[model samples]
Target chain A: MSMMKIGGWIKRILVLIFALVYLAPLYIAVVNAVKPYDEIIKSPLTLPKQFTLNNFVEAYQSSNMLELYKNSIVITVSSVALLILLTSMAAYIIARRKGKVYQMLYVFSLAGIMIPPVVTLIPSIKTLSALHLLYTMPGLLLFYAGTYFSTTIFLYVGFIKTIPASLDESAFIDGANPFTTFFRIIFPLIKPCTATAIIFLGMWIWNDFLNPMYILGFRGGKTITTGIYNAIGAYTSMWNLVFANVMLASLPIIILYLCMQKMFMQGLTSGAVKG
Target chain B: MKHNKLYDTLFLAPGFLVYIIFMIIPVIMCFLYSFTNWDGISASFRFIGLKNFVNLFQDASFFQALKVTLIIMVLTTLIYNILGIILAALLNDTGKLLGFSRSAIFIPTVLSAVVVAFIWSYVMQTNGGVINAIIEMFGGTKVDFYATPMTTIFMISGIICWNSLGFFVVIYISTLTTIPQEIYEACKVDGAGWFYRFFHITLPLLAPGITINCILSVAGGLKQYDHVKVITGGGPGGATQTVTLFGVEKAFEYNRRGYSSAAIIILFIIIVIFSIVQLAISKKHEVEY
Candidate 1:
């Protein structure tokens, strides 16, 4: 009994140590971001000797952090909102109706799941350019709508299917049209699915690097990811500024994740189990 | 019921219109473009049959990128699953410390790959890097992570694992929750040891989750781009380029749009092949508990 108890304590201590080491990069970034360049070079692992916020100030300016934030917010919000509205409505029909057409549509929409986004990127550029939508926010937004349409629709269809059809039938009996019944009755109940989709889509769009780099281009404006990439590229070895840039770029998402830790966990693993 | 048809079209048209024009058509266009000698900007180009693919198999850098990508895919998948399972087992219990550790590990997954790469690029730097600094503190020689193409590939793979290992662990933990406690009790009643229970009970029951994780990890690894691009820009004479990065360079820098399309198509084919094979293997191993 005593041996078992000792083993439990040892396991706890080891896990704690491993967690600290796992978080070492984040810790290093936090400490170094406050230090001056020379101080960081002297002791990258130690706490700042002379604390400074100048790195943040400079990083914010040099990266045009506000503009990046604006572009990212606009893109993420508009894209997620658009995707949710479109996919949920579409998923509702596909889930409720039993027909060859709906079944085919379901398969058609889900076809994008296996096709990596990179495959569509170069060709999409041509299409986007032809439509005169290249280097525009809406172009990128539409591209994302296409890219993630499968995954989002998959989530919605699965969740919507689980909700009893009788709920919508009652809504229809109460003089609610299909549109009204869906928006009023069905949409509200799938908040969990919507939440999962929002978290996944928001994270993907916000953190997306390659697609945004080309689709948005420099003129369409930089996202947090591309803006930071360019900013860090300009000052490659300046560890202090790099740390500051990384922190500024990451802190918002990290804080959001922490505040919604349970939802984030559920949101991430929700789709995995269904697979 | 006439209006019902209209309503269905109204609901599906907008989404499917955008999807068809932007998604399906582009995918088809990609297939068609792969056969052409189009230089992206050219008004006219000829369909050169399988020439682009024929050349790709001969391209040495293409093969190098494929090797690097395969190495990273295999390495990261192994670490993410093996370590992910162990970490999941440890953190599966309920406690404030376990919760804190879980959140600590998952924090990185929320951050952008660019942010993760930037933090790790600095952390793994040779001269003034925190990793090497700690090594020196322990009376050890400093290690240069980017010393060679192979080392850099391994380093980047490790960084990739760090970035998303929490995701795998979370999935595993959730899968663990689905198992019944009665099974464990029964095993314990039969005098089964910890290892015996894990290998016999836990492993088989976690098959569904393993199948999902394997498929996800394999695809995610094969499609890797952001971290390698941000960290090395596929550098050191392009020794570290993944197939995607390689294709991007060819398309944008070299203006070999047709060739780039072929390269991406090959990657897509490879991903499809792997996912299918994995699904088949996992289907055979999947235990219905």
Candidate 2:
């Protein structure tokens, strides 16, 4: 009994140590964000002598925090909303229907999952420019919709399958049309699957950097990721400002993850494990 | 129930329209563009038929970018999976420490790659950087992480792994939870040790998770852009340039859309090949219960 107790304590201690090391970069970013430049240079590893919020204030102005938030929120919200609605509706059909055409469509959608975003990015620029949608928020939003359509549909199809066809059949028997049946009964029942889709798509669209950097060119409005990258590019050596920008860009998402930690983990693993 | 053509068309048409135009058409266009000598800005160009691919084969920088991309891909994939499994196994217990550790590890995974790269660049900087600060405090020499392109690429790969290993660990942990306790219990009854059970039982059961994680990581690593871009911008004469970065620079900076399309298509092919091979291998190794 004593030996087992000792072994358990050893494992706990080891885990604690590993956690600290894992969190060291974040700790450094937080501590240095509050310190003056000289203080950080003098002792990067030490606790702040005098904590200040000046860095946050300066970072907010320079990075245009409000505009960044607005742009990121609009893009993320619109992209995810569009993704869930379109993919779920498409998935419902794909799950319910039978025939070579539906099977072909399902396979066609899955093919998008294998194609990296970069594959489409180059040619899409031409397509967007031709449509006069280049360097716009709507342009980026549509790009994301197209890019993630496969994975989102894959998740929804798997989930919509477990929901028996009887529900849809009953709704149809009640003199409702297909759209009415899907919207009233089927959609509401797939709340858990929708949550999984929302969380996964939300995180990806929010954190996306490369697609926005290109599709939304310099003339386009800035997102949190690209805005911060541009802001910090000029001041590479300004550790205080850099850390502050990093914190601002990350804090919202981190807080959201913490509050909904369970959902985040479940949503992430569900798409991977099941698909 | 009879199938309603109107409802089917209404439901599928909107999403398929956006998807085909933006996703499918572009992929087809990428292949079509590779055959031409289109210089992005011009509306007119002649078909060059395999010239871009032939040129890509001859371009030294393309090969360099391919080498750098492969190095980062292999290194990050191995680290994310190997270290991920170990961390998941160690933190699989149901204790406060385990919970705290899991959350701490996963926190970075939520942050943007650009943000994570910036923070790591600060941590790994030569002068007064956190890692160097600690080393110097202990009477050790400070290492310049950006001493060479190879070193910088390797360090950036490590940072990418650090940022994403949490994600892999979480998936592994979820898979771990699915394995029955009876297997390990039986192993213990037979005098099997921790390593013995882990190798024999835990790993085989975890193969499904391993397959998914490997495919995701390999595709992700091959398409790496944000972190390397933020850290090095593939600088010092394209020393640390990834294939994606190379293709982007070619398309945007040099306006060689045709050539750049060819470059990315090659990368696309590599990713597809790797994913298919991994799925096949993992499927073969997957133990049936």
Candidate 3:
């Protein structure tokens, strides 16, 4: 019994130390962001002698934080909303119907899951330019729709399979058309699945760096990731400004994850494990 | 119930149209473009039959990029899975310390890769870097992370693992929960020590999660761009460039669209082959619950 108690105490202490080590980088970022440039250089590991919000102010102005927030929010929101609607509708039909065509369509949708986005990026630039959507927000949105359609539909189809067909039949008997039944009846019941989709897709689209960098380019507005990259690229040696920008870029997502910690983990694991 | 064909078509058309136009069509175009010498801006180009693939096979830089990519892939996959399992097992209990540690580890997973890369860049910088600061405080030499291409790539791989290992850990922990307590109890009753139980009971039961994470991490590592881009921008004459970065630079910067497409297609093929092999192997070993 005494041995067991000693082992438990050791385990707890070890875990606590690991937790602090895990948080060390974040501590470095947070502390350095508020310190003066000389202070950061002098003693990065210590508590700041004096703190200021000047770095945040400078980072906000220089990086065009407002424009980045606007672009990121618009792209993430539109892409996620469109993905949810289109994937769920398609998944609904594929889930309900049993036919060769439906099965083929399901397989076709799953094809995108394995192909990395970089594979299509070069060719899509050509397609986008032809459609006059290149270097535009909507172009990136359509590209995301194409890229993520597979995984999103895969999730919805699996979830929709578990939801009984009786609900659809009842709605159809109530004088509802297929479209109305799906949107009004089936969509609501799949809230958990939709929540999962939203969390996964939302985080992905928001944090996406490569696609936005190429598709949006310089003339097109910058999303947070690209904007911060460009902003910090110029201020590389300015640790204070860099951390400030990092904090600005990451705070919203970090806070969101903390607030919805359980949902975030569930969404990520469900999407990966099931898909 | 009878299905309305029109409604089904309507439901599928929009997504299919986007998917086909942007995803499928582009893939086909990529294959076609690999045989052409079309500069991205050119209105017309000549048919270059197998020229890009032939050149890619001979190109030293292309081979270098391939080597770097594979190295990063192997390193990250090994670290994320091996370290992840250990961390998951250690932190599996429901206690404040365990929960807090889990959350701390996962926080970086939520942050953007770009952000994580930037934070680590500062931490790893040679002059007055956080790590170097502590080292110098103890009268140790500063380690230059960018001393050589290989060193830079390995350091970047470590950073990538640090940023995303939390994700794999969470997956393992979830998988750990699904294992029955009785198995561990049974092992304990047999006088099996922690190492023995872990090897006999935990490892085998965790195979499915291992397969998923291995595939995910391998694919992710093979396509690494964000961290390397922010840290080095594939600089010092493309020393640490991955296949994706090399392909992008070639296509956009040098107007070698055909060659670039071939490079990316090669990566695609490699990923597909590995994924298939992993699936097949995992299927053979999967323990039915």
Worst 10 contiguous positions by lDDT, candidate 1 chain A: A266-275
**Each candidate's interface RMSD:** 1.5, 1.2, 1.4
Per-residue alpha-carbon lDDT of candidate 1 for residues A7-83, written as tens digits (9 for 90 to 100): 77777778888999999889999999999998887777778889999999999999999999999999999999999
Colliding residue pairs in candidate 2: none
The 10-residue segment with the lowest total lDDT in model 2 chain B: B128-137
Q: Estimate each model's TM-score.
A: 0.98, 0.99, 0.98
Q: Report RMSD (Å) for each prediction in the order shown.
A: 1.3, 1.0, 1.2
**lDDT (tens digit, per residue) of candidate 2 on A120-237:** 9999998898899999988998999999999899988988989999988888888999988989999999998889888888888888988998999768999998899899998989
Query: What's the fnat for candidate 3, on a 0 to 1 scale?
Result: 0.81
| DockQ for each numbered candidate | 0.76, 0.81, 0.77
| CA displacement after TM-score superposition, residue A101 of candidate 1 (Å) | 1.7
**Stretches of candidate 2 above 4 Å error?**
none
